[model samples]
Target: MTGVTLAKAVKKYGDVQVIHDVDLSIRDGEFCVFVGPSGCGKSTLLRMIAGLEETSSGQIHIGDRDVTGLDAADRGVAMVFQSYALYPHMTVEENMGFGLKMNGHPKAAIKAKVDEASRILKLDDYLKRKPKALSGGQRQRVAIGRAIVRGPEVFLFDEPLSNLDAELRVDMRVEIARLHKEIGATMIYVTHDQVEAMTLADKIVVLRAGRVEQVGSPMDLYADPDNRFVAGFIGSPSMNFLKGQVAGGVIVVPALENRRVRTSVVLPKEGATVLVGIRPQHLTVEAGDSSLILELRERLGGVSYDYLRSSTGEKIIVETRGDEALPEGTAVTLDFDDTKAYFFDGQSEQRLR
Candidate 1:
């Protein structure tokens, strides 16, 4: 029930550094998520906080204690990894109580904690079952239950649901969210899945190449990203980018059949190339005698994403509702509110406000 703080935290191995100076603060009882693509140092940063990885410099404080040099077991943090590291021979109850048992806690006390955690995770019925006897979701719940029984001040999860199938992943997401709500413990979750981060995090830390890109609430990052990397990485289907050239205070997009888009944001110098970004939801398409072709249409129940490609091979995804299908070869024209378009510097890929 305490917050975690990182002050200019850095991690290194001999000569190469994997985690840069990362400054983050996870509020008390907050669900903070570290999210980015693979090898982005989200997991490395999480391990640094869990004391699994040594901090090369700076300080990590779990509440008021500087746990930078503490052993993993002494850090007061429990980490559930991408894999459910369960003992194949132990029953669910035994696995949940193993840590306390090893720590020399009384049998009665261990049982009480195990029972309470099992009740929270809805694993009371499967307590007698071994790992081999349980489904993927059950095994993951057992893993989480194991962490809960230890009663750590902070819980760290490194993609705990990645092993589950699509259906089970959704179910476990709900289960984990509910568990956090019930226990109200400070949790730090790491995942490459943006959907998981968007759905679960109270605050999200977006990382790339060992650097902290941006940190904010889900919608805050979505609606207002500091750079093109964050803007493209944080949303589903991702935001579409079209190249444009500044001319007479307007952007001319060749992908849109040389259409001109005017924006209120200050423009770059004349003839400077810029990136015009528009989310799929903001783009509307209509059948017309234009070079943009409807390459494919994916029907996903209530929503459909119409894939379009221009003469220059620039691809765009137009998200639409309903099950209607547009012919693959249909020529289309793209329409979007000029106000909704975001302009970014083509060179730096940074947002131009």
Candidate 2:
């Protein structure tokens, strides 16, 4: 098995600790993504796995071997960096075969490997072209081909699509997905874009301040979050948080004009402050007695988002797929199912279950 495992991993710079003690296991041939905000140490952790960063104190196992102290070249991992670090003077074929040639591989073997990688990446047509002559997406594919030719047990991608334009990013995303399916190598990708993480990963490890917040499949984190942060961070447009309090065996949301809402879980003690979470997709705009003022509407072809402000100045986003457009400055009532609502303790910021 070419799985990767980290046991009590910790990274520190002098007295300040960056990567907290983390324990994780990535199965063989699984696509795992490390996702978080900048400075959360996702890239640092990826580099640690690739042997590019030193592990302060922990055991890092790649397959059956403990590779904690091994150099990058001995780790059997190929990293595709964000920047296309190609030799501008060399052709794509030469750049892809350079590593093997330096390692004293036979000319015939190197040629065969390069040819296979070029075919997989659809770079056969541009193999003779220099980096300066190819487009950004094509250059990135060449970089990936370089890694493919190495035939490492694991592949590390560090925001490889971030440098490309939006359209090119989408195109490269599909290409990478296809390549993963074709090669079936253990892949660990790092990205700040949740959409990329959601679309590409078989399992997602959400990090915050160098600590693991949650680790699960994308839909697991989306539908069954363990805490408030996971609930808010995993979804697009984020989850709306409204002020509420537990009173008389029910939760009452002040932002919704003290409407009594029911919960599937046991309520906290009376007068305890709590937060009511509703996803934008779950909320519907309808005529009612609620005091939500529509501030703006964003139309995106088949769907739309209505930005509303509550009486308490809390901003709320409501997603509607209907073709009818709601005008601005319209006072509308927001409706949502009670079962779809999430409750969190305001003091601890943890989900109230």
Give the per-residue lDDT digits (tens) of candidate 2, residues 40-153: 999999999999999999999999999999999999999999999999999999999999999999999999999999999999899889999999999999999999999999
Clashes of 2: 0
Candidate 2: lDDT of 287? 53
Which residue pairs come into collision in candidate 2? Answer: none
Model 2 worst lDDT run, 10 consecutive residues: 286-295
**In candidate 1, what are the lDDT values of residues 128-180, reduced to their tens digit?**
99999999999999999999999999999999999889999999999999999
Clashing pairs for model 1 are none
Stretch of 10 with least lDDT, candidate 1 = 320-329
lDDT of 1 at 304: 92
TM-scores for the candidates: 0.98, 0.98
In model 2, where do residues sit more than 4 Å from their true spots? 287-290
lDDT of 2: 0.93
* TM-score, structure 1 vs. true: 0.98
Q: Which candidate is the best by TM-score?
A: 1
lDDT of 1 at 320: 94
